[model samples]
Target: MKIWYCFTPLITYVADTPEELIIACATMNSLPVTIATCGDFGDPIQHPPCDGSSTLANITAIITSILPSDLIVFFKACKHYNLNGVNLPFWRNWFAANPSSFLIPELLHHLHKMFWDHDHLWCTTVVGSQEIDFRFVLLQVWTDHHNVQWYIIGVIAGAAPTDFISAIRALMEFKYLTEAPHFTKKQVVHLDCCLKVFHWLKQSIVDTGAWWGKGGGDKPWAIPKLELLQGVVPSIYSHGTVMQWSTDPTEHVHIRVVKEPSRAGNNHNYDAQVCRHLDRRDKVECFDLILQIYDPTLMKMTVDKAAGNFSLPDLCPAVSDHLN
Candidate 1:
């Protein structure tokens, strides 16, 4: 995955200084990975924002300038305007197909005290067994390309909630989470298969408890999460837990890997990038587990069905720079 990060030093309120860069990083805490502050800034820097605040509106312009971004980050300056943070609703969604129309102010006020109530909404059923939950979605959506197929070979697993996905959607569609008392059908919120699928697949395993350190001796610290990753275990095996939904390998022996296939098709480079995220940032890591079970070349993931209690991550905005 190729991600481009851009920031106008002015956004951070400090230009050409370490303080400015640090502030910019602090502004972009909503997404994983570091920022490559280009256009005005040189080289990609590991930017983890300090406080939860973000310059979202100003950053939107920079993100829009770079079209076709796998992901985008921003910093907002509501403080400069003396307004509380931009009151982006908790349930608004990032409508990639229609970004501009995602939010409306009157709608925000209406959503202020009620649960989401969209009068105009449509829902689609992901055709699969009720037993299959969020984990299967990752194994299924691994390769975005049409040519590469996916398969689940080794052992079968069970369903688990991907908190990362839940967090992102909650933020994007907060306004649409409930109906605007003043207007009906003027704003609509619904599940989107394509956008939510990709968004969550890249973001699901982030900051989850399942992702622990590899034993650094003292306090076990988690690694940074990456936008892309792929892998094969150094080697392993175990003999425990016989359920179908667990990624946990209780049998003492297991293979854990996350690889990112470059557009250039260099698997080795992809592996290095994965390591950097897992080793450096201390963020949670997500790998497509099905590959260890099935062959990548033979069959492809044809029908991904999410039965019950399952939905796409972007259905609601989950992450925000509102907190530190």
Candidate 2:
């Protein structure tokens, strides 16, 4: 009888003594693949800085490790190998927070919940928000969240940095107004930086020139800055903040809860849609990458079903490496 057979290779390595994550790539490269190994990971292995280990870093490394057509990472996250990991307490607390209860999350959620924007980039021939010829628009995330709005401003790149004197001078031209106060200064910005963005509401001013502003002129009252976070991609900026902390190398904390029906049925597919990147066409599928400082003392991810335990470092090498 003619039979069809399959042989699945195991591309696995463990880093017990994690440094800057040099060992993982070194192993994957220095070692040779038997018939069991996959050839997608080329001769030269390139990676960002790593503080030994992290969840997101592992996830990204495996994703880019394969060829264009391979579906290993998908199958691993979706089925085969269970993720069995979670963020530290700080990150978990951050997920449950909103603008009203923001400060603590900064303390809880890995010191930062930065949003890395893979959309609205200049390199994609994508026009600036205002310059769009089409009448594209969006709905509010929540009506009650009053100050949640995008502020428009001009940005000039490749210029030198501005000192305190230049900053005040620029503000003079765009003089502040003394209008009747409807909202307090706190409502204008929800930053927990301890480094205040502005002093008052009527004179609500934002630091538009900082490297975070992406060269755009900002107002003290702009709801979301949309430029604080940075990425390796040039001309591309993210709209979020970051944090620092440590989780126990042994324990685990859960944040992403996929229901049974979701995991076994169509729910997973639905999630794949909603969490899709703003520019799905870029081949940058999802924004599942969650960065946090590598802390072996906080919490970790577990199967939560039977007997399974894993750290974020066991998964995300790319993101973890970069963030650290």
Candidate 3:
């Protein structure tokens, strides 16, 4: 059986220490893990250049050590924290330099024209605020799946090219692994497009100085290291496909199902809230299963009778004729 693992902000709270986190991961079956940030991990500065904490480094090393080498791990960069380090400053400067041009209609128009001509892929833009008052761009990448219709797998904010390029590269790599044909001419064509776009974006970032630009700081600096971005290509090449391995679906469950009810009851008691959410979900699932197994036609007839429309002919003359 295939399983998908996700390390999100909420779940990370279950483990207090790195060792505990490793234990929690061990409990899960072999699966592709999508790693995101958590408050428990503390600040990035605590672990890296600033000090030798190695909280994240240790957690990830443990995860990789236990999981198979081919196991796909998706590193979702947090926009709030600037996972790449360069995002905040680069975008701050980009907005300042451009002035009224960041995420404006003109920029969006150009982006849409350049990227959305193909039917399979498209983008959506929303106006968002950052740092409380400053405005930022929220761009979402969506794909038209032959089975699932439209699904958004990536969301990138700010005007920095590195952020955009990185997000786009991940999305395209995912598409190549999940959507492309296998061992066929179509596969080659699809992969060519993916590589072409990937290279183009990387080159654009370098050429435009977006990779190494001065913004919200003293001097121009090199792009911040994003360890998550490093594994994407290799994982795709090793694992045949990354389909259904993303955290988007789990995220949707949290946002649409868990958070609201938890808040409505008692937001303060984290453990109780989680327990209640799980209980409610299980009950709901069982009810749905019961409905699925039960005959629907009987329910329809009962409803019709209760509404004083008991005549079968009134409901469906064809059914009445067949009965006669």
Error of 2 at 88 (Å): 26
Tell me, by lDDT, which candidate is best.
3
Total clashing pairs in model 3: 0
Better of 1 and 3 by TM-score: 3
TM-scores, one per candidate: 0.15, 0.17, 0.31
**Model 2 ranges with Cα > 4 A deviation:** 1-127, 130-256, 259-263, 267-324
Which tens-of-lDDT digit does each residue in 1-324 have in candidate 3? 999964322211111122222322311111012232332121122122211122234434444444434223322221222122111222222222211111111111111222342212222222122321132122222323322122222233343345454545543453434443343446544644554455444444334433333342322222111212222233345443333233455556767676766676765887787778778878878755654465434224322545554343244465444433
Give the per-residue lDDT digits (tens) of candidate 1, residues 1-324: 999875322111111122222333322222211222222111112233222223444334345643323232222343232222333422124222111111111212122211111111100011123323343464665533221111211011222344433432342243233222322232221312222342444233323343223452332222212110100000001111111112234212222234221332345667676666556434322222332244443123233455323222332233211110
lDDT of 1 at 154: 9
- Residues 1-324 of candidate 2 have per-residue lDDT tens digits of 989865433222211211112222222211111111122111112222222233335445545554324555444452221222221212222333221112111211111111112112221122334533222223323322121112111221112123322332222211111111232345223222111221221121223222222233332222121111111111011112222212322223122223322344454466664344223523332233222234432225433445443434545566544433
Instruction: Assess each prediction's global lDDT (C-alpha) against the native.
Output: 0.26, 0.25, 0.33
Among the numbered candidates, top TM-score falls to 3
Candidate 3 lDDT: 0.33
